[model samples]
Target chain A: MENVTKTLDAKGLGCPMPVVRTKKAIEELSAGEILEVVVTDRGSIADIPMWAKNTGHEYLELVEEGDVLKHYVRKGGKTTDKEETPVKTITNEEYLEIADKGPVTLIDVREPDEFAAGHAPGAKNIPLGQIDKRMDEIPEEGDVYIMCRSGGRAGMACDTLETFGRKNLIRVAPGMGDWNGPIE
Target chain B: MKVAIIASNGGLFDAYKVFNIATAAAATDGEVEIFFTFEGLNLIHKEGLKQLPMPEGKEHFAEGFANANVPSIEELVGMSQEMGVKFIACQMTMDVMGLKKEDFADGTEVGGAVTFLGYAKDADITLTF
Candidate 1:
């Protein structure tokens, strides 16, 4: 008989919940052992793999049973880890700080007229409508931060950068107008 | 580098949502853009961005810009350009708002839904603000 793998059901959760639970399960497991995670939240579908990559775990399988998503992951064998890395969640202040530093690209994803009125200091203008045809303008190096009037447009930019293999990407927590900071 | 943002709501909160998305995209090195339509045109109106009440529970901007560090409407529009975020005002909303090209910020442009649709059609991802 095949050995039973530890299963974690994290259905009906949102965003980081499923990923957090899976991380906990992987921590309790031994090397070569499998962890099966069942989740119903759609956000979990994207969060799991990202979590695994960030945590140095190997993702094995993903299966959908009925309405539930089942993911199988393997934990690393090393018990003594040298360094602990911080998770990559963008905050409003952090966004400003990064922008203040050089070698950063900041894009406004709003309409043209809106940009002319007010925006951040040193922010480049590229309405979301033109991003596809103007992909050449994007740089392959350095951190890229996406912003709009709200958080919605930034999410799209984050997903786009991730799809294009631009790993150093983050969405502003709030947005340019909503950010309680200085604007150009 | 393809970025697409959907602006469905018309309130100040909605405008802020789109602003955040564009700024974050720019930080990631992607040529970022935001498509404002329907109620989104309100975002361009100088008055619309200023003196608006903030969303509840948000201590910074919600308490009011005077008390908070939030940039004013004019300031946000200026910073958006500095950050490389392109702002596109919807033509339909412009007509509804009874506004003209001169009514918006310095570098504002007018666009219709077809323009935004064409741009977002093949985007890596499209998010509604």
Candidate 2:
């Protein structure tokens, strides 16, 4: 049994709650410390590990006791810096300038319906959630620019692509929310 | 940050707020969960798209939003789910309202007060509307 620095009782909570409580509980611990989360939401079995991976925490183990689940996570000293990526970002104005100069690969990471509602003319629709499984769909050779309703999902997509060694990625900040360009 | 939202109102303005905040929080890596009870359950009903708006005082704003290409409540709900925000409908409320599992939009789970309370207890922030 690992030394438990703290324990969060999230039993009966569903979906994101268990993960949410675990995140806060982990924050209170010091580097290399351990946090235990007990939850009854079966979704946490997958959610916790994904959250740990996304946030760069160590998912030590999961123990199922009866209908409850005990998850052990080791606090990472540099969790805050783990998500930092070297991807470059460009302003919407700069993106428009570049697009006007020549054809640019613009990837809209919003949902299909959102994309259908309105999107930059000639932009490719590859939603952020499906980016990982659909990476191959993105051309390896091009100046790839990503955008969402806002710049947030685009930033996340840039980080995800960076991890996969995809360079030449540029994030369009102040995305569609402030896009003055014509929509398709 | 962890935000637990208890939405008990079916009003469009309130539903918009719930979806907006939930999606925003998720975007910033905050874990978010919304529990819909009482009238709020109507927001997730299959026919919710038609009944989403408040009955008064917001029609012009709603029209403006539509014309501006702003997302509707249904679209916002979809966006929130894409951002990993969890939407849960109250089971006891469903029973009282004669709603079944099929009555809600896809991706909604039915839960009880205990389940929602469990979430609120551990959440860093909790709000009711």
Candidate 3:
């Protein structure tokens, strides 16, 4: 939470001006670093988020205390850089297309409950925590498509699988959050 | 607890009043729903909250809100949504006002008065604003 690298006191500023100033400050912000902007403008809560969305910044949140509003925005430019996994990856659409042609190995690294709730059809469930003991269940000779709720755990699973010298690992980027199709 | 709110006015304050109560009720782990009908449909228009301005003559209230840090109408609605408050857009009003289902916020249910009543029928508390 203390990741904020800079603070802009934008109090007493009126409409558009505060947001404009925020834009200026955001330009100077380093990628992935959070900027804590203190503003008195009530509209900033909505305006800041809108501006952030339009400008491609990550609107973390807004906190109101008494008569002051604090908006946290992170320079979204390189935020994905940190989350970029080293493993080979495919989108849900790509995975589906490949699966449609043949029996593809799709492993869901989400917890059992989440996998049970809804997941890609034919995807095997192996919780990220249990990947070690469940290594034998994972196919070693085929193109293994691993996924999770988002893409975080699947990346970790890729690292674990890599350690075992099982090189055919492809994580589903932005996983189930964007999964499109029928789920059993 | 189940909470139901009827928003009949379209003013900026109307949005604040409806969402304020809806969010407060929902904060307590209640199932809350706000029915937007008649003029209230203006509050749910895709860009309604942003388009709606402080009433004329109360324009100075903008400064006061700025000074007081009142959450914007959009913010309140967002908070209400995040707190699980359901928003229902009156389909009849939509047809009357030329508002298509896509004209309202995403996830806003397009329904008629009877549909809203169905949800409010068993509500523990129901209010009209």
Candidate 4:
């Protein structure tokens, strides 16, 4: 088998850094080529395999070379277009625009502790736990958007709404952590 | 488990990030809901989450969030809705922003603070993004 090999020196990079570098390196290679990724984060040890699967690259070998972790990935003959393509997310200006013209309902899915700390100026506190029973409370006229620390719980809230047949919903991308714009 | 997202940031970055998270959560058979507030309200604006700028030295905030396995506000909304996630927005913020019910993302809700808090109160895990 013909194989072209490249080395990625991502030893000190963080969680997504190594993955990004690895993806970039692979993008430059042809089928049957191998990319060797050296990373320092132990998280990569597990992330690499998932990346390979998610990206359609074949994960050949993963080894712990002392404190550094190494991964060997090969471009497969078949392309995996099922992989996700990165997209631009919501922004501060757009957020204002949407809110400016919405017959929508907004909920702050963060815990009571976090909500008390500080949140968007006029957001409601619908902690994730009580959403089910309180589903009736959410207005029936407009859409709903759920937000939490980062994007984790918001995603959860989005999912719940779908199950109850409450169509027209969204999550605050990047959640509260990324909201640098004006609050209340 | 049920899930919800708050897309408070106002650009494509948050829109897409929220979507990815919803997809992942829905894949696990979890119900999802997303509420937009503050700047997050912008995600519902017409084509609001499109072509957002990438921060200098940052490959676009949304891309970074995606590369990190995080969801964009819009994407979360779409994916969650596809897999059955509910979406919402803040009515107070809308009023303050001089917005109307018709201006938000097609399916977003305009709600209050207590509404979200009500949900967060009993969730297995609650987070603020």
Candidate 5:
């Protein structure tokens, strides 16, 4: 296609593969450059847009012909994990042990639907995307435990919060998705 | 994430769903293990794809997938294994189906419920289909 800088053929891949590959391909692109992802996975129709939105990229358009879909996305200046601060990490077992003792300011960084399904009691629902705006809701000074389905989103939240001057943040890796503790 | 999948159906669509999810999870940096039991073992059988049945009213799926070049269940199975998704066929199912370990593709593990539960225990996501 005209004006297409590069093409990634993720054809025949199912589910999240197209999106996962798109993330890597887009990173190799300079700001304002475009990456074309060709895939047969229909899920990418919705998944690609959501990924682009979450990663600060511009989803240009999707061209479809038969089973093939060509997705155009323009690279954003900064990455979703640009300010990555590899902070301290804790496991689900350790988090559970701490929670059993008393109250902990655990921030569940997953979406509302996931939170509503199951979450730690007394855990705040400040999703990773909304953390920047909801920073005030967190305690001005205290140890805050951040968690998500696994740990990726929580790590992102920690990075974003770190940029906002959060000092006492601990991440729960292998997060709620592996939690054997009580849920509210 | 560590993902544990229980595949208990042998239908074509069912096989596709399981393999699709498994391969996708593996591609997304998740460690995936699929435990095939009951009728699900048909998927790993050497001749299963040739005999795989289309679900009622969804027979067009085969034509559509073929026309679109979407990988078949067999292809998806290969892709899943290539992506490092562990494949475990049930020992009891093998006896019931009169199949031996050699009846499946190379590198498939044979295990029972205890093995599956051991892997599923620490899994972040457990799905049954």
Candidate 6:
């Protein structure tokens, strides 16, 4: 029964929203403080715990009162930083410089619609979501370049690829949004 | 990460928000599933493209989005599917709404509350739109 330093009313908010709001709320609390969140979304039972685990916070407990759920979370003294991926990154200009120099494996991590809407010519569509299932499609030996709309998804893809023993991967950061190159 | 989205609203804006979040989650390598129930089932129907309309008083906002190059709800659904976001239509809702399997989009799957709850049970994040 830790003292609640703050309370978040996340009732009626859905997935991501509750977690998103909880994250912001937790930031305002001091280390070792507890934050109580009341939510009506049944999904929050799983969401809040997962979010806490991923972010290195302690998920204390949750109590359900009729339709409302009350979650207790203990803030970690220091928020754990995400692990650093070994993948290297390149600028859009740098990618262009090496685009036609030789054979390069460019993996577009954007959704197929976005890829179809416009993408760097000759780029292969291996969206981030399908990466696990499509890992075999990636060549074992090649200059692998991953790009997304911005750099976030590409970074995630790189992290996933790294877990699969991919090394020396290159991330096309600040991706297609800034690309002035030709589109497919 | 396993993410489940429960779409219960029929408004075009709500569907748009759901798809947008679904696609973004998929892009982040999250296992995303969108369950269409109640009025939300209309979003996956074959006729959804023609039937989707902005909620009352929000009709004017649609034009703003169109002018900004935002994709339509249909296109967003396509994007969500392409990004590996699973689309599930509620069987109970279909029965109540008089919708058949053939009435839904090509990739839509049918399931009941139990099925959705199973996914939600293991999901890292669950949302209802």
How many clashes in each structure?
82, 0, 0, 145, 0, 1
Ranking by TM-score: 5, 6, 3, 2, 1, 4
How would you encode candidate 1's per-residue C-alpha lDDT over B2-101 as one tens digit per residue? 6888776666667656765565454333466677676666676666656445556675755553542344555555656666777778887778768887
Report lDDT (CA) for all predictions. 0.65, 0.78, 0.79, 0.65, 0.82, 0.79
The prediction achieving the highest TM-score against the true structure is 5
CA shift of A130, model 3, Å: 12
TM-score of chain B of each: 0.77, 0.90, 0.92, 0.75, 0.93, 0.94
TM-score of 3: 0.44
Show the lowest summed lDDT stretch of 10 residues, model 1 chain B: B64-73
Model 5 C-alpha lDDT per residue in residues A28-121, reported as the tens digit of each score: 5545557899998898998888777756788999999999999999877633332345677888999889888888899998889989999998
**Which tens-of-lDDT digit does each residue in B1-129 have in candidate 6?**
899999998878787788768865664457898889998887887777556878788788866765544566777777677667898999888888788988887788888888899989989999988
Total clashing pairs in model 1: 82
Q: What is the C-alpha RMSD of each candidate to the true structure, in Å?
A: 19.4, 17.1, 13.4, 24.5, 16.5, 14.0
Q: Report the Cα lDDT for residue A145, model 3.
A: 93
Which of candidates 5 and 6 reaches a greater lDDT? 5
Candidate 3 clashing pairs, residues 3+ apart or interchain = none
| DockQ of model 2 vs. true complex | 0.02
Q: For candidate 5 chain A, which ten residues in a row score worst on lDDT?
A: A77-86
Q: How does the DockQ of candidate 1 come out? A: 0.02
Give the per-residue Cα lDDT of candidate 4 at A184: 57
Best by lDDT: 5
Over the stretch A108-169, how does candidate 3's per-residue lDDT look in tens digits? 99889989999988899999899988999988897999998656678778888888888999
The fraction of correct interface contacts reproduced by each prediction comes to: 0.00, 0.00, 0.00, 0.00, 0.14, 0.00
TM-score of chain A of each: 0.48, 0.55, 0.58, 0.51, 0.57, 0.56
Better structure of 2 and 5 per lDDT: 5
Better of 3 and 4 by TM-score: 3
Please report the TM-score between candidate 2 and the true structure.
0.43
Error of 4 at A60 (Å): 18
